[model samples]
Every structure is written in C-alpha cells, then in structure tokens.
Target: MTAGMPAEKSMNFGPSARRLLARLSPQRGQVLAVAALAVLSVACTVIGPKILGRATDVIFTGLLGKQFPAGMTHDQAVAAVRASGNANVADMLARMDVVPGRGIDFTALRNVLLVVLALYVVASLLMWLQGYLLNGVVQATILRLRADVEDKLNRLPLPYFDGQPRGELLSRVTNDIDNISQTLSQTLSQLLTSLLSVIGVLTMMFVISPLLAVVALVAIPLSVLVTRLIAKRSQRQFVAQWTHTGALNGQIEEAYTGHELVKVFGRQQEVQAAFAAKNEELFRASFGAQFVSGIIMPSMMFIGNLSYVAIAVVGGLRVASGAMSLGDVQAFIQYSRQFTQPLTQVASMANLLQSGVASAERVFAVLDAAEQSPEPARPARVTDRHGRVEFEHVSFRYQPDKPLIEDLSLVADPGHTVAIVGPTGAGKTTLVNLVMRFYELDAGRITLDGVDITTMRRDELRGEIGMVLQDTWLFGGTIRDNIAYGNPNATEEQILAAARATFVDRFVRSLPDGYDTVIDEEGSNVSAGERQLITIARAFLADPSLLILDEATSSVDTRTEVLLQRAMAALREDRTSFVIAHRLSTIRDADLILVMEQGRIVEQGTHQELLAAGGAYARLYHAQFSAAAVDLDEAAAAGAGQVPAGVGPRAGGPRPRIPAS
Candidate 1:
C-alpha cells in the first residue's frame, strides 16, 4: 500500500479460463468445423505421399523386372530387364517415376504431377479455412473477455477498490488479455496443422514399412520431454512478465494523476527511473520466456533431420539388396520428417500458450473475487415516507484490533436533522458508510422506516438517501445531465427546480449552453464551490427520504462555505438529514446534535441546550468560535469572505422555509 496503490490480490487464471470457455461456448461449432477440416487436410497429406510411393514402386519393378541375377546394381538390373523387353526399360521406368522421370512417359508423369497439385490445393484451402475460423473465435472471445472484466469491476466492492492502483488493473484488463487473445489467434491453427501432419505421416509410414515406422518415432519422446520442461519454465516467465507490466502501468497512472505534484517537486527524473526499472523487468522476463521457447522449435527440427538421415542410411541398404523397393525408402524419409513437425509446432506456440494462460489467469482472478454480498435473501421495499433512522448497538471497524466505532446507537425521526461532531478519525465517514451499506457492521443493526436497513435492497435503499460530500465527485457530462443523474427520468422542469433549491440554477442559467455544456472528467471545468452546489442540487433532485452530508464544507473557501450553509439549510428542511460537519457554525440549528469522541457519543442535545450545559458541545462550540474568528481575521487581511462563528442575523432563528405547493 503505497501513498496511493491498489493491490492485485484478485489476480488468477483458473476462473478466467473457465469464464472464457463459457463465453466461447457459442463458437464451439466453429472449432468442430476447423477440426473436421484438419482431419481432411491430414487425409490429403497421407494419401498424396502414399500415391507417390506406389508410383516409385511400380517404376522400380518395371525397371528391374526378371533381372539376370537376384542381386544387381540398379543400372545392371535395368539392362537385363530391357534386354528381355526389347527397349530401354530405364526409359519406360524413369518415365513412370516422379523423382527422376528420366525419359518422360507423358501420361504417367502428368498424372503424378496433377495428383500432387490437387493435394496441395486441397490442403492449402483446408488450412486457410481452419485459420480463418479459429482466429475469428479467438479475437471475438477476447473482446467479450474485456467487456466482462469491465462489468465485474463495476460490481466489485468499494473496499476492493480502496488503496489499489488504477494502472495495474488497467494492464490486466487490457494488455494481458490482449496478449492471450493474440496468442490464441496465431498459434491454435498452426498447432492443429502440425499435429494433423504428424498423425498423417505416422499412419502412412506404417502402411509403407512397419520396421521403418518404429525407427522414425525414436525422437518423439525426447522432443515431448524437452517441450514440457521449456513450457513450464515459460509459464513462470510469462506470469512474471505480465506482473511487471502491470507494475509499470500502476506507476505511470499514479504519475499522471499526480502530475502537478511531480512537476512541483521536480521528480520527473525519479518517475522516469521508476518506470524504466519496471519496463526493463518486464522485458527481461518476457525475453527469457520467448528465448527459451524459441529454442524448442529449431532443436526439434535438427533432431527431425537427424532422424531422417538415420532412416535413409538404414533403409538404403535394404533397397540396394533384394529386401526392399526404392519406393519404401522414399516413403520412410517422409515419415521420419513428420515425427518432429508437430513437436516443432507445439514448441513454436509455447510462448503463446504461456502468455495466454497468464493473462486469462489474471482476468479470472478478478472474476473470481467475492462480490459485495447481496442485500438479503428476501428484501423489503423502501417507499418515500417517514425517514426514521436508528443505529442500535452498532460496533464496526474497517480492520480488526482498531475499532472506528464501538457500541454506538442513535435515532432521528422524519423531518429532523442530526449533526454528528467528531475529531478526525472518529469514524464519522465510517458511520455514514455503514448507513450507505458500503461496509457491513461487525455487530448490531441499523433501521430505517421501522425496518432494518439491511432488510432493504441495496440499490433501493441508496435510491432513498442523498449524499453531498465535501470534495464533490462529478462525472464528465453536461450540467443538466450531472444534476439529472440522480433521477435520470427527471423532466427538465424538475431538474430546474432541484437546481433552484440548492442555488445551482443561478450559475447554470448563466452558462451559454444553459444545460448542454460538457464538463471535464471530475467536473474540472466548474469551480469547486459550483461543483458542490451541483452535487447538492443532484441530491435535492433525488428527493430521498434520508440525506447524508459528509464533510460538506471542509475543503471549500469562505464564500463557498456560505453557499454550502444556505444549501444545507434549504436541503435539510422536511427531510431526515445527517450532517457530518466539523464547522460547528453550519449545523447549529440541528434538532439533535451528537458530540462524539473516539467512536463514542459523549454528549447529545439541542444547540443552546448543550452550550448551556458547558460540556463537550460547549468546549467544541467555544473552540470553533476562536477558530472562526481567526479564519475571519485572516480573510479580512486577505480580502476574502468568512462565516461568522456563533450568531448572524438568523442566529437562534426558526428553521428555514421548505418548498410548499
């Protein structure tokens, strides 16, 4: 947990692969189609070689038929057979043979070449079809993989997001999955092609000569062993490669988000060094995986050539004698090459397998993470009615051994406002977070409208509570859209009315676009004060039965504070409002004010009543008085607006007016 970083605890491959397969379920038919094509291509490959071998055998016997002796040189045997035939048997024979065809027998030679041409054409077409279909499944599935990952991210728990880096997650969701998808597209077809070729070669070899067939397989086990070892090592390196890539992404994201701070601190060099280190780390790891896996293909090819040479040396003598025909030797050499082709292919694609699995693993991790538990087995609906809230013996903490809130309980009726005052880290936000169901309580319960808040659907409960934060969070959208987000179905007049309630209409009506202006990401286009007002108006538009205003004025200027005070008063009328404010002046008229310390309520009362009691509330009130006076004095020196501490024209006055028909 750096100053700002999210952990990669949810990274895994098992769940992701399963999810991928499920999504690719629709494309299984394509896979089967490709498989059928692979089988057909293999058939062509085997049959083509067999036909050439038969042609060789027929030509050899034609040249050596009924030789003068049982053993003779190829030329002597042709002389003897030609003596009997009354013509050059070599011419008749070579013409029938594909390899030599010394004197072309136009008909026989043409047939062999034509058959070879047909096999090549058929095999190429099948391979092309297989590649096209497989690639289609791979890329399409990956796009869906990214979409699903994004959806899961949207649903993940808030705590899951806290303290995590944005860049690392982006890497997993984008780069890693993309690498996997690419590997699948490039390797799957080649893998099947290589495999089918091997099978076809082996079967044809058996048909040609069983003894030579066994010799060709001598290197198969050795190749598989080497491949397995290299593949396992590659998997680890691929995982490391992806992890480093994510770390680099996290660093870059953080640097950009805090670009101003980095610039001010003159830490550009430092940032560069950090990024370069991670970048190099990824490079080294990926290089290791790729370099090792790359060795497998060439090594298998070398072994394949060696096996072919050995088969030729051994099978050649048999043909020289009366034991074999020239055709058997030719077929055996072809069969020997087949042994390593598939091995070579799988070895070639080992990198893709590793990277793909690594990325899918990371994706699966997020998909596998436990989501925020659903609201309940059966949820009670919340209607817009009385806003009665109670916290009964609620004890909660974000972490064990550090209680943020302990045995805390309280209640407020509808049409009432509750002000909760506490020092920083007194669990003010935690309390409201519980109410928001952002975190579950360790003990006790909270109720709304005479029913446990937990009994209501999470979305439905949130729909009935409006929150206005100190640092107002605004999405990039039009002014009207931001205000209308709370009630997307809201009419234009309803949005304007909501804006008016929070005095947001004043600024918005002045804009040239009125309601169509586009805001930057985080509403950076608007002033901080105006952003707060917009959020307040958004909450007002929601018209929830309960309102939660957390740190509503902590980070704003004095003039902005004044605006917030007005918005708070107007918005709190006729609603159940919980205002967590350190600025005592803002919540002075609360129907109930609870002064809290160390997660426990030390004092509870009306404003004047607590000031008269001269306890926690009195101390807080006086402390803020001096602070407000100091702030006002500072503002006076700087020519700025200020909020008067205790009493203004409306000090100790009745509640502000609520909108009525």
Candidate 2:
C-alpha cells in the first residue's frame, strides 16, 4: 500500500517499454515527419560515398594512363603488360577504363567531388531538420505525461497520501519525469538516425561488392551478443538505481523535516547513519549501472574492427585479381565503416534507453494507481443548511480484520454544541473526520440535514463545515493572506473582525508588520499559541454552519483559552459544533456531553447530568481535576517554604487549568 515503494518483483521490460513508446502515439504526424527526414538524409549520405568513389576512379585511371606509352590504345596497354609477363597487372589494366598517355582529369574529378559535397550538404541539412522536429515530438509527449500525473495526484484518496512518503512521491512526480525527458531527448533522434543509416549503408555495401558486404555481416551477430549481455545486466542496475534514489530521497526528506526533533532527542547520529546507508546503496546501484552499460560501445567497436580487417584483406585480393575495380573497393570500405558505426551507436544507446524506460515505469505506476470512487452522477443537494448531522449505524475500520468503530450512531442537532471526551484511540477525532467525509464508512451512512452525505458532492458537503486541529498549519504568507484562506472573498473588515474575535489582532498589532507579518516556511517564527490563534481566526472567517474543533485550545494559555471560549460561544450561536477535547472544564457548558470508550458512547448527557450519573464521564472528569489538584497542592506547599521530598525549584509550577464553568 506504500506509494512509490520499489516493487519486490522483477521488472517486466517488454510491457513497460511498449507502454512508454505508446505515449508517442499522439504525436504521430511529427514522428512521421522525423522518420521521412531520416530516410531522405540517410539516402543522401549513402549515395555520397559512391559518388566520391567515381571521382577516385577518374583520378586513378588518368594517373595510370599517363604511365602507358603515348598514342597506345587501351587494348595495346593490356597486351603489352601480358607480353611483359605481368598477368595481374594486365588483368587490372583490362578492367580499368583508362585512356593511354592521359594524366589526372581535373575537370571530371572536380565535377564528381562537387556532386559528393552537395549530397553531404543536403544530408546534413535534412538531419538537422529531423532533430528539430523530433525534439518537439518528445517534449510534447512528456508535457502530456506530466499533466496526467498531476491530475492523478488530485484524484488519489487521502489514504493513498497517508501511506506514501512525501519525498518518495515527489521523486516519482518530478525526478522520474525529468529522467524520462532527458532519456528521450538524448536517444530518440539518435536511435532513428542510427537505424536508418544502418539500412541504407548495408544496401549500398551489397550493391558495390556483395562479397565484402557478406564479410561485414559477420560483425552483426557479435555486436548483438555484446549488446544483449551488457544491456541485460545494466537494466537491473538501472531499476535499482532509481529505486534507491526514491528511497534515499524519502530518507533525506524525513530527516530534514524532523531535524529539530532529532537534535532535541539527541538522535542525530542515528539519522545520519540511516542516511549514509541509503546513500551508499544508491551510489553502488548507479555505479554498477554505468559501468556495465559502458562496456557496450567499446565491445561493439572491437567487433567492428574485426569485421573491418576482414573486409579490407578480402577486398584487396579481389581488386588485385581484377574481380573488383579500385573505385568499387574504395567505396565498399566506406560503406563497411558506415554500417558498423551505426551498429555501434545503436549498441551504445541501449543503456540510455533502458534507464529512461525504468523511470517511465515508475511514473506510469503512479498514473495507474487506483483513484477514489467517482462522485455521484446526480448529487443530492442540502437546500437548508441547518447543520444537523446524524451517523446511522456507521461502521468503519482502518484494517479489514480489526474494526475500530462498529455500528456507532449519534446526532448533533442544529444550534447545539456537542462535546466528545475520550481516552487516546477512543475514536474522538475519527468521529469528526467521518462528518467531514475524509474517510468512507464501511457500513451505514452519515446524513447532513436529512440528506445522505454520500449523495452530496464532497466539496459541497465540506464547504458547509470549518475545522481546526491540534496540529496547526500555516503556509509561508502574510497574516492577512492566511486568514483569508478560509474565505478567499472575505473583505478587509471581515478579516480584521475574525482576527480580533479570536485574539489574533491583539498580537498582530504588537509585531512590526502587524497583519502584514509573514510566516516562515515552517511557521516557526510564530509561537505555537500564536499559530493556533491564527487557525482559529481562519475558521472564524469561514463562518461555516458546522464547526469541528479537535483540541483547538490545547496550545493556548489558560487566559487565551478562556477568551477563545467566549469567542467560540458567540460564533456557535446559530450553528452546530462538534468539539473534541481532553479538558473537561472547557466542555462543561456544552449542550450535550458524550463520553466515548472503545469507539462506543459509554455516557451521553449534559456535563452535570453525566456527573450525577457517576459513570465514564464522572471518572474522566474526576481524573483530570485530581491531577490538577495534586499539582496545585505541591505548588502551594512550595510557596509556603515546604518543598516535597526530592523536589526542587526547577520541578515547575502547577499545570495551567481552564476554570470550571
């Protein structure tokens, strides 16, 4: 269930590779243009060597003709060489179309050279155009892929985010996608050009001299063997490299996020040790992948050299025997080089392709994940927002085998304050979360104003409620901006009113920037109490019909809590509110008090009525007051110059308490 975790199973290269290429399908027109250009470029390049070979023939024939006796016909030159007992030279002379007593024909040579130069120029221009178009195609494909991933993130359920490490998920979205872009940018055009060159060059080699062409073919099997061996080994390393990269990023992010806690707990060494281990793993993986794939190019070149040596030796014998002309031999050698060069290029590109595909697989896994259930096609509307919430036989569990809440039911009537008090893991927070639809119930349904919450659009249901949690969240923005986040269209007067109502304005005026004060990235510039007040102010601005406060006053001082209580009482005038708190004094005035134990309401009544019943609520009420009484007694004794045994002045004073209502 952990997101972006490396799969324990081996990578399926074929399917993933095919899927990666399939992403290019939308750019079919651009791809086709690139391919056509590649074909034309390769064709021009292929023909260049043959045309130059003709120029070589013109020069060679003219040079040899000058060595013959002046006025001697081509037939006489061959006959004279035969009579001179040089039969090999006679055969060579017979094959060559040489004019006796003639020197290098500069004009013909110049004209052939011009044609070769023109072919090369046209080929270069076409190749450049091909590269430009291919770049656009690749960029467009990656752009679509990035958009898809971003959309997928929004559709994912909360549980998906809960299970995923932030850094690992970021690595998948940002790092993995970037890797794919680089891979395509480096390989696509080169791969196409190399493939086309191979085909064109091979065809020309065969046409010029089939025997030498056959010799060059010997390198193909050897090259394939080398490439396959290296690519197979490197591919696993590439997968490992990216996997470890994600793991290392997760570790680093976790470490940095909790850096303050690490120092406070003196666990810096432990965190560093863990980081080093993951870093080492990533290093080893990257090195192995690079080193293995690095072998392909040199190994291919070695195989090509072997083929080149064989072709050269054989072509020389054929030329000397007059089975092939000097010009054809020269052209065949050039074609052989062209053929092996592309093969080597292809072999070298295997590793890059594999690395890119590895990243593509990771990105695709995110896109392929299961999303939250679709919203209702015909969503039900809550016409009257009275804020009456009812849980009808609701059952839920984080795990299938271990139920947390089963068949639990409750109702919070409009304009009433419902306070829930419980021990840890008693499902106090879970109750409010269900109301907000953060999670789906396993059975039964929650209704808002007599309408099933499931039938309403999630956003529409949440829009009617406001929430404040124990862990305050403040982004890096001015105080005014943070407050306005609750209601984006709130006027300046409303923002100031909410801030003053929640006691935020009192502190804001004391700061140099007042309401314009900027919160840092961590919001560490503000005290915990100040941050909590800001969140409360934000909720106030929302002015929702239903409010859920989870330990909203836990971080504030006793005086501030008392002030906030008065502010909240006024705010809750015509709205329903669910307040989860451990402080019994804060909830003594609630219209209904629910004492929950093990996900069931063990006691339900007004605070004083529950106390009269002397059940779970009574025990919880007494437990909190008893602890505070004990601390107060100790502090009182110390003030009277009578310190308890083994106690010192630094033992601290009585804990802050909210006055009983």
Q: Give the per-residue lDDT of model 1 (tens digit) for 446-551.
A: 9988778888888888988998888778888799899999899999999988887777878888888887989976676788778888887888889888999887
Task: State the lDDT at 55 in candidate 2.
Answer: 87
lDDT of 1: 0.76
- Please state every model's RMSD to the true fold in angstroms: 9.1, 4.2
TM-score of 2: 0.92
What candidate 1 gets wrong by more than 4 Å, as runs, is 2-23, 52-102, 322-328, 509-512, 617-661
**lDDT (tens digit, per residue) of candidate 2 on 64-161:** 99998789999999999899999998898899999999999899999999898999999999999999999899899999999999999988888888
lDDT for model 2, on a 0 to 1 scale?
0.89
Q: Provide the TM-score for each candidate, comma-separated.
A: 0.82, 0.92
For candidate 2, the C-alpha RMSD (Å) to the true structure equals: 4.2
Residues forming the 10-long window of minimal summed lDDT in candidate 2: 1-10
Best by TM-score: 2
Model 2 segments more than 4 A misplaced: 1-8, 628-661
